[model samples]
Target: MTPRTGGRKLCGADELVFYDITASFEERTIFTDILKKTAERVFIPLTVGGGINTLDDFARVLACGADITEDSADKRSLAGIFLSYQAPVEVPGVPLYSYLRTITQKRPELKMTARKFRARVGEIAEQLDMDSSFITRELNVGFSGGEKKKIEMLQLLLLQPKLAILDETDSGLDVDALSVVSRGIEAYRASCDGALLIITHNTRILERLSVDHTHVMVRGRLVAEGPGSLIDDIDAHGFEQFEVAAQAAGA
Candidate 1:
């Protein structure tokens, strides 16, 4: 197979680099090697897509140093799990309400029309103390930190996923917004009997919910484990002891 040609006389580095593949199944492995080399050289936001079929494909491409993995929607969407990101990306052209509708529609089990779904979203937005006009705005485009987190909470509540993974939802949020986000989380738990896996350093959000387990991780290693009280201890004393233990173990 012949490799495609492209060129740019770069004085320094480009702001962003995109690598897209249209290789046949037979040529997938070849592009994987190419991607590895490109990742090694490119120091910008590199988004790679095409011919990725499974989770393993994503893992492989990411391991190759691709910054973002672009795969099919269904492949990335784990059926009963909802993940609220710490930093939500903005999609300028997509309306918040439409995006939510499309995602919910992907789950055949979720039976609701676009109109009804819009109303449902508005109700959740109100609960988050967000304006109804936000639904008409572009997804995360110019929203404040609190608004973005609230939008995530809105999605979590609307989806009613069996498991919600919240990644630092409290980060950058003020006290009121934190309370609103926490309430949305609790509503999901109460209504769906859903489980939560909250990843955060702030105990403020946890103070509102009933935490069953706590694990202190340092340098990607779990150094301590305890009940919910561990949160209070960490809040009062800080992670100094845990960090010291992790360092000792590594040494």
Candidate 2:
């Protein structure tokens, strides 16, 4: 999750940037439609990308109510959106401390009472058996992949959105880290009134996080949706079976 401008502000008010570098055109269209609907209801800015290449594509996206920013060489002009950013996650000489300060302030809601923040941070650090200072610093920078995921889960705990989306957030965690991450996710579910959409290929992480729904994607389409048990089946048999099933249906 990208850190918000301040700790207290809720998400969705600012432009939401999606890095969909490998999504298909149809998938992009569907995503744009979703963004449009979401923006209409929520009244927030939406920015989308990944595999975009034509002026008409930009026009279509903008017509749907998005502010476009394109990093690709393809030049396009759309009324609702403006395109920029040539590379993903590029910070050109942006001061890390300044950036962190901005995020901390912009999402002020995320900043709990200093006592609460410190207590929760301490508890999480203790649970992970790390130093409190280490956790604080890690939350800002120099975090490993697992640590970043854990911090992100912590952020979710703090923010408690109506819906949370985890896009392959478990890809590189070790067993212990995965365990910690799962516990944080579970804690969020137990404490918050929110639903989670976790996009992960690994089933082990699901052991702790009770998934209300599971979805399988193939060729940028939702090929299957089922209970958490689907994760078990996928773990045992792998997605090859699902791919075959999808192919058979297409045939």
Candidate 3:
């Protein structure tokens, strides 16, 4: 029932009409034509883009209209849905790596040029500093958190997915190990025209990364977002401001 600009009339609609508006009074009223037009509309909840690359950009977009965002607990509903191939969701209750032995058997395409395939996988594995011997072993078998993450990156290199959503990829890694993980990630970024989404609270791994945007989600809602600089700021100041913003938005 919300119509923004260029509407001649409003037909008699349903009951309980109300909308949320997220904007400063100045921006809402400064533009004479837009303000007049808004006064004529039925929406109050401004859809301000909670994701931003800079504070000025945030202000700019808010001036326009935006108010929505996302992240985890989202693992199942969000990540699970987007991931259709070779994900843990494919075989419930089975360790992801356990399927590796039989996976190639399931798909003939993976078996073609098997020798080249193993070598290719070895190169990527070494990029992660993962031992070549571990290839035949089960996944996540006595692997450290960082090791597991690296293996995940190995899968990414092998599959070359068009889009990858890595939740908490840097959860457990020391400074040195993180560099290996980052390198693997960078390699995958370089090898394909795919998109990568790395979700984590840590900032060290991002130091040498070329991040397009970083979004901060508080209580499952995105409160702020910006460029790579945002990561450093968050590492230093944390998400206090974003938490407050999310709360205010909900209220």
User: Candidate 1: lDDT of 91?
Assistant: 94
Model 3, CA-based lDDT: 0.58
Off by over 4 Å in 1: 1-73
lDDT of 3 by residue, 111-221 (tens): 546577667777887778887766655556666666666666777776665467777667657787788878977997899776778877777778878999888887776
What would the per-residue lDDT of candidate 2 be over residues 151-239, giving only the tens digit for each residue? 56655554455456677777777888778777877876788765677777778878876667788999998898888888888988999
- Compared with the true structure, what per-residue lDDT tens digits does model 1 show for residues 1-251? 12223422344554434445646787554267876877666555456645555555655665566644244445445335578989899999999977988888866667688788877888888887899899899999999888899899888888787567899989999888898989988888778866789999878898888888998999888799989889989999999989998888889
Q: lDDT of all predictions, in order shown?
A: 0.76, 0.59, 0.58
Candidate 1's TM-score reads 0.69
TM-score of each: 0.69, 0.56, 0.58
- For candidate 2, the per-residue lDDT at 19 reads 68
Cα error, candidate 1, residue 38 (Å): 40
**Backbone clash count, each prediction separately:** 0, 25, 11
lDDT-superior candidate, 2 or 3? 2
Measured on C-alpha atoms, candidate 2 has an lDDT of: 0.59
